[model samples]
Target: MVSQSPPQSHQIYPDSDGKPMADNTEQFRWIVTIQQNLDWLFAEDPNVFVAGDLLWYPVEGHREICTAPDTLVVLGRPKGKRGSYKQWEEAGIAPQVVFEILSPSNTLTEMNKKQVFYDRYNVEEYYLYDPDKNDLSGWLRVDRNFDVIDPIDQWVSPRLGIRFSLNETLQIYRPDGRLFLSYIEIAQQVEQERQRAEQERQRAEQESLRAEQERQRAEQERQRADRLAEQLRRMGINPEE
Candidate 1:
């Protein structure tokens, strides 16, 4: 009789859920801004994990209970690539911070479900922003449950050290007083900086050239004076007098 192996179990959840990352340009812009800015903010820290639109399975062995936040930050987890965040594999550390950017397709029912899921999974800070309405909302974990933050405007994130401003449009500022920028804005700023640096370099070169020319002119004048003085000496006259 041939030896038979035991049946394998379905323990792996898929990396993607066949859903698009964003519904429209506005939603996609918010997602990219938050993800990129947070990535830059905590880049030097080895223990902070940041991801955008990645599937997060809060419970192990049950792939059905999973939700992908627009952007999520895990404080205790190591920074690396992950197909999906399996809570069991991450030392049972849930993501400390989560952000959701509202799209037109997002319904009230869906958002309520997300809130419950984040609450049940022990998320410390939850933020929701709607670009169309210029609305921002926040929930902080109070005791064992997540409670709504009253007057969400001008509220600072405890974990992120970033402040939210609602004037004109939704603006998020870093601790160092720099506002979060979209991909296009960041690219433009980089180009501007490059241009400024080039101008400075050109100015420095011009200054250097002018100094060299001045030195040459002074040397010629000194040579001319020396020749004149030598001629005077040949004529037995004091050039200095």
Candidate 2:
């Protein structure tokens, strides 16, 4: 089914207007990281839904709703563009996963409120990441209840089967244990795969050429043998040998 987001309260106000929206550099950096991993994570698992800058309505008429979860994933949901995800419209199901990237402008009280909202809405998994402090703490819901999941030296996602570890820097896991590609790294990998394929094609062509040359040489030798046999027959001796 298609997404059914509530009507947006949007206005065409520029930066000069001093609009009432929060924007910060730390937030932008976290967004970049999430955006970069979107395709990789999607490739690894298609059932996962990743969204950013979108609206989510937990309650239709009540006063609680969240939008644009820096990054979020709803397992078993269709991956596509949507104006917003209205909880009531999505089979009365809320997002299974939610991630919050911390910004310096955010306060302890504000973060606590978001945590409470997620707990009330039944978000199955909640993760809070602080890039500045390299702090990543998470919680997993058990029996519809939130429980703290402590961060470790190497973060492993129990739900996604993906590992996030630092090897001098934060790196994701590939299925075969190699590092998962970052945005730029993925691009380079694609190019390298293409080059390797081209090299294989060239090798195949060279092998074919060598095979043809060998066939021609064999044909010439056969002809020479036939001529010798004919000469032996003319000399009046048994030519079978």
TM-score of each: 0.93, 0.76
Q: Write the per-residue lDDT of candidate 2 for residues 115-143, one digit (tens) a residue.
A: 88888888887777777776777788888
Most TM-score-accurate candidate: 1
Please list the C-alpha lDDT of all candidates, in the order they appear. 0.94, 0.69
Q: What is the model-wide C-alpha lDDT for candidate 1?
A: 0.94
- Candidate 1 stretches greater than 4 Å from native: 1-10
Q: Which residue segments of model 2 deviate by more than 4 Å?
A: 1-47, 62-64, 174-178, 235-238
Candidate 2 achieves a global lDDT of 0.69
What does each candidate score in C-alpha RMSD?
A: 3.2, 6.4
- In the predicted model 2, the residue pairs found to clash are none
- What are the clashing pairs of model 1? none
Tell me the lDDT of model 1 at 146.
Answer: 96
Task: Count backbone overlaps in model 1.
Answer: 0
* Candidate 1 lDDT trough over 10 residues, lowest sum: 3-12
